[model samples]
Target: MAVEPLPEPLRPAGSGPAWRLRYLSTSWNGHPTVASGTITLPAGTPPAGGWQLVSFGPGFNGTPDRCAASQAGTPPFIRPLSEALLRAGYAVAVTDYEGIGTPGESSVVHGPAEAYAMVDIVRAARRLAPVSRRWAAAGYSLGGHAALWTGSLADGYAPSLRHVGTIAIAPTTQWGLQFAAAGNPAAPVNPAVPYQGRTLPVTHPGGFRAADWFTPAGLDLVDLAGHVCIEQMAAALTGLTMADVFTDPSAAMGEFTALFDPHEVPVRRYPRPVRLAHGTADQLPAVLTEITAGQLAAAGTDVIYTPVSGADHFTVAAAIAPQVVQWLEELFRRP
Candidate 1:
């Protein structure tokens, strides 16, 4: 695990923002491993305490280490969010997650591995810059699940760091719902069409879209999930659902049940301020955040849930980033 300055292309635009790419010596599921990530230092800093670490976990980039967000460089949408945190006097550490851009198995759907990456990257980043003991976790989509889980275990995982709060934006709250919804043609998330001049059976999850959407040969390529980047896989699935591939939802999710169980949705065993947000029009079950947030509050965790009307899962991340940063600043100000 080594720390080095980011390459010229990877660095932030304009003058004055210093950043680095870090390969971390960390663990996943109790085994020693290495991971890669990016750490961006705030510009023109000098608070009474050093810059607060705002640990960010990005959504799916792909299973391959090369697709890691750190390696892809900061995407356009993410640049604004990162700048917001920087202007607020916060340092940002974004974990590529385990196995992405590093040598190791990627268990991204498995909560623990993603959580471990977010927390451990902070431990590695502290060595490279002036970071305060306080830290906050924030993420969107899949990373939302990772950020919350990290906040939940931060106290025990890295006892030296101060756990301030967590922000989960459009998180994947119920994985099972996604699997079951695959075959329900009544409410198709992906575009559906007639097959061979006959109405598609509700049971045929891959009810099928036009040839322009998913050709027969293209269907065979869906198996390439872990081998390529997320964008590619997403493109291949333009008109399909889990049912097209997995006829039996429960049986198909062999290891996933153990990893992303709704029954085991995050609970804040450790006390900290947490904020949860979801878009009203998100493809994810609309009621999920309300239910999950309620569960956290019932479990005695301080929770603030917001539902943004008309926002879809993709747009919700940008919609909520500034709000999350504001929450982090307020949490840091608290005595």
Candidate 2:
């Protein structure tokens, strides 16, 4: 493990000393990879059992090394939220996900790769700071998806750590269906779909070709997805619908489903309680979270599902941050 001070932009003003970490984690294909993250603790002395930890996953940041949270500026919604978690007396550890910072193409939404990075960062944080064994996994958007996977995988992947719970805000699920909708001219354009068009192929095991999926116009913009951050790629692909980009969105639908299906969360029963929150107005659709929660509940996982009235994808995290902190407090209080 390697530790260094966090960059100025990523360090919240009132939070305690924070650091950037490069540690080992397993990739989706079961290969060892170096992962990076940021860790911030609450200011002042530790509590009796040391500060409880929240291992966090930030939303999509594109698939380049420069997009890693620790490398780029603070990710969307991370500063205020991290500060809030700090005020609530929890140490925060945010993973860059596998390959974003260290090496290779990042598996944009692969759950196993993300779960490994999330859980391992907690172990890395323990080495550098005073942290309680009891910790929870939390995230927003793409990070939220990672949190669900972490909740399902942590108990077996890191059996020694006392994982208390999981909290997902506007988490993504059913990605294959989302991608399939790209063929619908009526379906609203989502920049992420084009962005993933380039990334998913790079990381897929079957060696799928981006050329097989994208139109000439999309090929021009999606190439940026590999090189720039999400916002930049979104800007470049703005005003273009998926049909405008994909030759036939359904042309490679079966292959895309095969690649993305295993990445869906709540695939297995979570050993810990899971708090799932989504905004009714989120572009990703609230029904996705409802379906995931239903599956988890049916499998006997203790699930707490909440739907925010008007929150959008970007605002859902702030909408439920306070309640989420309270949920964490109650979860950690258990014996």
Candidate 3:
């Protein structure tokens, strides 16, 4: 494979808290793609110790531009996180993922493609910066899933990169469970549900009714249509018992049984440590901490599970930022 040249003056000169934004084309899910982002670093000699790399998977339901380093908001998304990591002396790489920067629905499919993009961005970052091969993955919500999946595939995708560990905050761990919870008519409508791999109905009262879950640009029509189907299915079985929801429970079981069981992938196959943090008060009915811990333990992978007492899905990051940063620093320090 031909190595792409690093852009001119990769890190800006005289950089006391400075960052450079650039775009690079790399292979993701076995296809050539461009990932755009800002690489932040403190003013100095580029850290002679060599920097650690952290690939950040932003939360679901927004375009990458919304989370760009310079985007304005009450709590700036990438800028704050990127600056924090840079202050901690780690080079951070944030991908717009495959679809967020360009056209097409962001692959909520949670398959090899998203996982591959996470790994490739790290590779691209290492080549672009003076960063060490030792690395960690961090993400929130849908990103939490991406980080975990990327960490899971470290051994296979980028064996050369040291897979230190990962930190996933309030991740959607159990897809099957989330789907069941989402189908409940009495359940509070979750804006994030459309990001998952389920179809929903727009007309359903309790379904996704927001114009845009993230911004006011309006919901993507494709995502809106997908949610409509899922909502319809959920409403059809509204008053029925759990057992009655399926005409053929076995077939329903078989469908999800084959696709949603990510734990079956074998933890021994993963080359890095995994850490999961979730809020116990999360409105979403997924047992993220327990499920992730159980799967990792069953597969004999090193896992750390933390459940924030009063935190909910939305507030998980603020509640766990200190601990998350500590864990990330530890991963960077690993030999």
Model number with the top lDDT: 2
Off by over 4 Å in 1: 12-17, 183-223, 241-243, 247-250, 253-259, 262-264
lDDT of 1 at 278: 91
Candidate order, lDDT descending: 2, 1, 3
Candidate 3 structure quality by residue, lDDT tens digits, 1-335: 23333243433333243233344443333556554444444545565646777777766544334432223121333244445666666766655565554444444444455566677777766666677777788887767877877777766777887878888777767666665554443443344333332322211225433332222212342245333433343343345442333333344334444445643323453566788888889875447557767888778777888888888766777777778778997776777
lDDT of each: 0.68, 0.84, 0.56
Write down the worst ten-residue block by lDDT for model 2. 182-191
- 264, model 1: CA deviation in Å? 4.1
TM per model? 0.83, 0.95, 0.69
Tens-digit lDDT string for candidate 2 (1-335): 99989876778767888999899888877888889999999999999988899999988878789988888856455566777899999999999998788878777778888999999999999989999899999998899999999999899999899999999989988877776765575454566765667668657745777788778887877777778887887777667776777777666556677888878785656788999999999888999899888989999999989999898987777778888889999899887
Clashes (N, CA, C under 3 Å) per candidate: 2, 0, 10
Q: How many angstroms is residue 161 displaced in model 2 relative to the true structure, after the best TM-score fit? A: 0.6
Candidate 3 wrongly placed segments (more than 4 Å): 1-30, 63-83, 186-188, 193-269
